[model samples]
Target: MANTAFMKPRAVSDALSAIVGKGPMPRTQVTKKLWDYIKKNKMQNPKNKRNIIPDEKLAKVLGSKKEISMFEMTKKVSNHLS
Candidate 1:
């Protein structure tokens, strides 16, 4: 069975909403959308595939961090969801 908490829809913060849009969506969906935006904008670091270089919009969601790992991405994004 899937974890209920992970699947539960949560409200997205304004910064994140700008990237994924405003809505109550599951955490998995939110992550998927976030990746979609990252790929669409070619934000992944060429030297290191695990690292993501946030664009102007993503920078807002990721705070002031210049670059972040894929694992860290999920952790940081969780902060923007309630």
Candidate 2:
């Protein structure tokens, strides 16, 4: 049988809610939406490219930090989205 628990989609909350809207959205969708916002807002730090500089909305999800690495971003965002 399939592992339903692992496969189940997580809901958005806390910080993620600010960027992606309130949810029950899948993780894939959340990531997509976040990238969309990032691209739209130009939040990625131009110097580093791998780092994202949080704007007002992104700050909420990033624990009020001003910047985060792209790799760490996914893990951090997951915390707010469960």
Candidate 3:
């Protein structure tokens, strides 16, 4: 069976809400919103798409990292979700 854990709604933190919007939303939706925000803001590194260079607002959710990998992004984001 497919894992449904990611589909379960979770409480979103204030920091995360700034990026993903108000949530009580599923992880999938949060990730989708994050991606939409990133794309809309053109945050992906030109040299390496795997790395994201976040803007001020995104930096808050990402803990102000200079750069972060796509894989690490999920991990970081998870911290902001309960």
Q: Relative to the true structure, how large is the alpha-carbon lDDT of every model?
A: 0.91, 0.82, 0.91
The list of candidate 3 runs beyond 4 A from truth reads none
Name model 1 segments beyond 4 Å from true.
Answer: none
lDDT of 2 by residue, 29-82 (tens): 788889999989998888988899888888878776668898998888878766
Q: After superposition, how far is residue 80 of candidate 3 from its true place, in Å?
A: 0.5
Work out candidate 2's RMSD over C-alphas. 2.7
| lDDT, residue 26, model 3 | 95
For model 2, the run of ten residues with the poorest summed lDDT: 2-11
- Inter-residue clash pairs, candidate 3: none
Task: Tell me the tens digit of each residue's lDDT in model 1 across 1-82.
Answer: 9999989999999999999988699998899999999999999999998999998888888886599998988888989999
Q: What is the TM-score of each candidate against the true structure?
A: 0.94, 0.81, 0.94
Report the C-alpha lDDT of model 3 over 1-82, residue by residue, as the tens digit: 7569999999999999988888899999999999999989999999999899999988898888599999998899999999
Query: In angstroms, how far off is 37's CA in candidate 1?
Result: 0.2
Error of 2 at 40 (Å): 0.3
The best candidate by lDDT is 3
